[model samples]
Target: MMRVKHGSFNHVEVVEEMIFAINVGYKVNDLCTRCSTSQLSQSRRFPFLRPVRFLTDSRDVLWIMDTSEPQIDGPDPSPAVDHGLLAELESLRQSHQSLRSRSAEMEETLLLAQRQREDCVNEIANMSKIIESLCSERDRLASRVGELEELLKEKEDKFLSKFEEELIERESMRVEIEVYKKKFESVEEEMEERGGLLSRSMEAVQTVKDGLIKVIQNVDDDKIPETLGDENGGNGDLRLDSEFMPVFEQIMEVRKLVDLADSKVSEYKEMKGKEKRQLENSVVSLTEENRDISSLLRVALMEKEAVEKSLNKLKGNTEQKRVALLQFAERGLQRVGFGFMMGSGGSIEQPMVESYGASSTGSKSDGSECEEEVVSLASTVEKIMKNLRLEITQLRRCLDESRSDNERLESLTTKQAQQISENSLYIKELEERERLLAQNIEELLVDIKETETEVDRWREACELEVVAGKNEVEERDKVVTILQQELEKTKSALEISNGKLKLKADLAAAAMAAQATAEKSLQLADSRATGLRERIEELTRQLEEADSRERSGRRSIMRICWPWRAFIKVNAGNGAAPRFPNVRRMLPEMQSLLHSRV
Candidate 1:
């Protein structure tokens, strides 16, 4: 019975994957609460125990044997057994009964052990959780302390830097004060020189006043051109001296004013000296304040260094504790694995008689006692097995729930990781965009600087152009003045030329009148020459006719001297050498001669 329960526990432990043992052995009434009949299966070595039930009695043994026969098919052994085999079978029954009794006792003992082990495991689990919580708190506190220490260090560094800067500023101010003191001394020297010059000018004014008064008194009345001086010379001289004497008295008053201006200069110099001393005192006070601030900064830096060292020590300790906890968990898992393997071997079955005990008494009263004992033992074993099985099933259900929860948690983790990745990518993209924006801002600033530079350049160029334009305007004005002068000169020359042309036109009109008179006289001369030439030509013609008549009369005489000559002379050379023959022949000889001559 104990072995049966132990076997059930081994099966449960294998199935549940727990470090603790599982036992399903329990009574029928208790079984209903622990494991359902559906959760159990036959062991590999107990193949005859079908339907999740072990063959505990003779009746179950007989039932298993009969039911498994059809599966054996054709092979059969002899029904009668030999004496030796029978004796062996009887010995086996006795050994089986003894094993059953022992198993019952062992089962009770194991149940008590399991309860105590469960309590111990529970305590360990709780302690582990508390330790984890404590470790987390320690880490959180250490981190906070580190942050505080870092903050203190940063503050200290800043304080020291500020004090250094203040000291540098104080030194710079001291240098500036020294420079100002030198400038003040130079100004004081200049003031002293000016005061001395004023005093000398005042003395010179007094001398000039004295000289003017003497000149006014020594003026000569004789050099003065006075119209009424002749009436009373003494009276005129006395009046002039009276007016000049008052002018000498006014010069004496100016010498007194010079003394007052000298006194005021000395007062101003004293006031400047007092102000210089006050400025020197202020510079000294600022130097003292700078020294005090430097001392405070040094103290803060020392505290920061001490805290940093302590934080480093705490961090090293936490690391060692973490390594130790990891090693302990590893060893625990290895022990659990070894226990599971041993339990698996114990899960295989023995014989049925050994699994379920029988009654030893034959009397009715003894038989009842024996049956009750066996039945009670079997019932207890079954109850314990049922309980173990139930526990295993419940543990398996818990493991399944835990697995489902783990899967859900893994899924949630994957989703969260994905979301985180996306957020990281988004952040990266945003950072890139921010970088681009910063670049754009830088570019914009550069552009603005360039634009400002260009504007400045353009402004300078415009100023130059304006200056050039002004110069050009001045040049144009100069040229316009020169051109106006030339235009006036040209207008004067044009007027003179017009007067000359008018005079020339008047002279030409007079010459044209003279030429007309000469043309009339030349025409009269030409007419007289024509008449004289015609008279000479007429007289020459008359003389030539008279000579011709004389020659003709002589020729008539000569013709009478010859025979044919008288006929030729009568005809007078054939009237005119035969122009028309009939005219010459019909006319008388003298008539024809006279007609031809005419």
Candidate 2:
């Protein structure tokens, strides 16, 4: 019996060896038949070949080799063999050698198959390792994407906060602009009041000047009458001159006061004009600043809108990428057969069980790890998608709020622009009015200068008239002394010559007529002196009143100036105009008084 081990030969090689051995047995059988017919003794010496049994190692299966003759116990046969038997033995030996070579070839083929199977297993292990690395890379990329999304959210939040802050600043600027407008309005009203006051004061000064001219005219008319009066009027003329000297001095003082007041008024007017120009410039600058601020706000809003659009586009791309990644993951799962495993349910479980029976526990553990990783990655992706959705919603809400704020800001800017335009127009109107007022002031100044020249001319004429009246008074005094001496000599002659009674009587009648005329002239001079004294007293009183009024006007102007100074300081600081409530109330009363005087 021949035994074949399991590792040494496979089933195909063992079968092939058995078949070859069977054929050799058949040849031997045929040779024995021929030998049996030719030589019976030889056939008896070498009996027909019996069946050969082959024992397999593990199965312990017995393969019996069949032969044409049975085995027989006999003595040694002859060494000499027939030619036919020798030829048959030689053919069987060649066939055996061929079978041995074919068996070696079969062993080589079996070894090649086993080696190919080992190579396929190694390739599968390498593919699984590559799949694991790819999954790990995908997971890392997903984490990086999540970090980028978080950074995007942070950046969006910061941008939103900055936009909100800008909106607040815009609102503050709008409020400040409104405040500036109110201040401008108040300042304009104050300027108007000041202009009215100046007009009223000018009117008052004109009326005072007219009254002074009338007083001067009255003094000139009274002086002409004093120069024409009788000898008794000389003493009265001297008394009038003494009284009128003080009135003339008072007139000079009043003229000085009027000039001072005029100068102060002109200075005040110049100051007001300068302040008005400054205010206009400030307003224009403020308007320009407001326009620039509005433009900047518009730019900021546009940038915010652009950022919102970019964020929306990024969100859309991220969503598309997420969906694509999810689809790719689904396809990967399908390619990895996980999708079939999930879809096939119990049918798939049976295959898995069979695979588990055939494959090692290590393969089952790898599949479980892959499934766990897929589930975890999917859950993480779902969570990330949810977070992205929430962030997108928040960004949309922020965009809506920003849009509303932008609309409000735009409205505010429009309103501010309108207000600025209106203010500019008002300023233009004020400028026109100021131009007209300046023209009027120039005319007034010219009239005042002309009146001053006239006053100086009149003063010189009055001084010359006073000097001529003084010389005429001295001549009248000398003539009155001569008349008194002649009258005494005539009375002595009447006393000595009693014979010329008729002549003495005629001289007495003439002297009496002259005496009556002299008394009438003396009475007229006394009345003229009383009238001149009353006129002088009235002129003095009027001058005093004018001086007092001028002082009051100066005081009021000083008060106005102080407030203006304060206003300038405040305006320089914050562009606010000053309020003069007291001055504004007082102006109307001054206007009324000036109107009454006029």
Candidate 3:
């Protein structure tokens, strides 16, 4: 028998109650098993749920009821006990069904949440990849921009230095050109003075030749009379020889002076020809230098145009990249915002619906906070985009200014080339004039040689006549004296002309020295120009490589962004809020990624 406490019910009553509770527990267990079985069948029905079937199915409730026979040591069971047991069992079955239905609904919601969580995780991973790629692209672009800026700075510095050198060289060349012009003008003046002297000398030689011819004619006419009277005039011949000896000596001195003048004129002509050839060579060298300078200028212009084209390409690439980044940012923001809202709403509504009015206020507050954060993020993105646009505009203005400067440089170069061409043409004209003068001088030299030969023959004939014409000696003495005086004047004029020729030769030597120095300077300029051209070529190659790299980068970025753009478009078209699972778990990571970059 069982001893019961005073406050407690009798053992019989206790036993009945205990049995009822056990029966109800068994019924609940059965309902739970049924629910679990139904869930498992439903999970099996969907291929997608096969992996999660175990997770979605509710656990089987095992009611460890006392299966052994009850020890009936108290009283016999009553009819009331049976009725009460029946009624309680019915109520328990109804409650068990309700709980089973509720558990099934909860399981379904859990499955949905799990599916969303998986999708959100996948999307978040994709988002992370995209963010990483974008960050890498940003870093690459920033590095490229920095490199390009450095290159531009170096190129600008080099160009400025080259321009300054060119300016200095041009100034030197101009000064040298002016010097040459002054020298040429001086040469022209000297040439004119020499021409005047040559004309005077020719006139004096003509007068001397005429006087000699008249004296020779008088000797010829008196030759027969002198031969017949030679013996009778022997004493007169002796007296005439004494008086004519000085005249004969004077004639020989005049012949020597004429020969000296002829030799001096030949030397002067040779020196003049050499000077003319040197001048022509100098002119040729100068023309060549000018051509080289013009070619260098053209190369510089071509390099400038190439640089401008590269700059334009860089600008276009930068603009495209900016636009792509903006579009990506906007799409990412939209996706993140929509996902956050959907995730928060789903998470909140689940608790609200399940809790049956519990924590409703807290869920509403959480949703508002999420919306506010999203709006702030959007506004910040907008502000960033605005700043970027402003920067782009400023860059464009700078590019425009650079373009204008390039155009101005091109115009200046063109004008300089035109001036150089004109100078070359002027030099050619001067050469033509010099050639004509050289021809005239050669003709004068030939005529002088012929006059010298005729003078020599006349001197021989006059010597023979002097030997035979002793009787006419007194009459010829006056003519001889006059001819001697004229010969002395011719010798004096020849001496003056010889001194001028020597001075002209010295001037030519000085001019040759100046030309050599000019040639050396021009050679140095040519070397420098070659160095600059090589540097320009290297810079152009670098720019081309940079452009190719930029193009490849753009292609890669396009390949990466296109899929995401398409995805965003599809979601938008569907008008369905993008769902993000595990928002509370992923929010921190997404925020860090976005905030750090933005």
lDDT of 1 by residue, 1-598 (tens): 1222334343323222212111222122122211122222211222222221223442221111123523343333223423433565466556555545544544554465456446534643553454355345445534544554464456446545745675676578557656655655665554555443333133334343443333222221123222222322333333435333333334344434433433443354345345445434533543443344334334333433443343344344335434643453354334334354455534422222322343122223332433454354445445545675576576556545544544454454344445434544543454454455445545644654564455345434433333233333334444666787899999999999999999999899899989988998999999999989999999999999999999998988775443343454656867756433344444467555645564
* lDDT to native, each model: 0.44, 0.51, 0.48
Which tens-of-lDDT digit does each residue in 403-467 have in candidate 2? 45445544544544454455445445544544554555456446545644554564444433333
Give the runs in model 2 whose Cα sits over 4 Å from its true position: 1-8, 42-83, 185-598
Write the candidate numbers in order of decreasing TM-score.
3, 2, 1
Task: Give the per-residue lDDT digits (tens) of candidate 3, residues 16-130.
Answer: 3223333353333333233234442333222211110101012221223333443355334345634655676678767656545644554565466456546544644553454
How close is each model in CA RMSD to the real structure?
A: 31.2, 43.5, 51.9
Which residue runs does candidate 1 get wrong by more than 4 Å?
A: 1-364, 465-598
TM-score of 3: 0.28
Best by TM-score: 3
C-alpha lDDT (0 to 100) for residue 68 of candidate 2: 57
| lDDT for residue 316 in candidate 1, whole number 0-100 | 49
How close is every model to the real structure, measured as TM-score? 0.23, 0.27, 0.28
Q: C-alpha displacement of 577 in model 2, angstroms?
A: 99
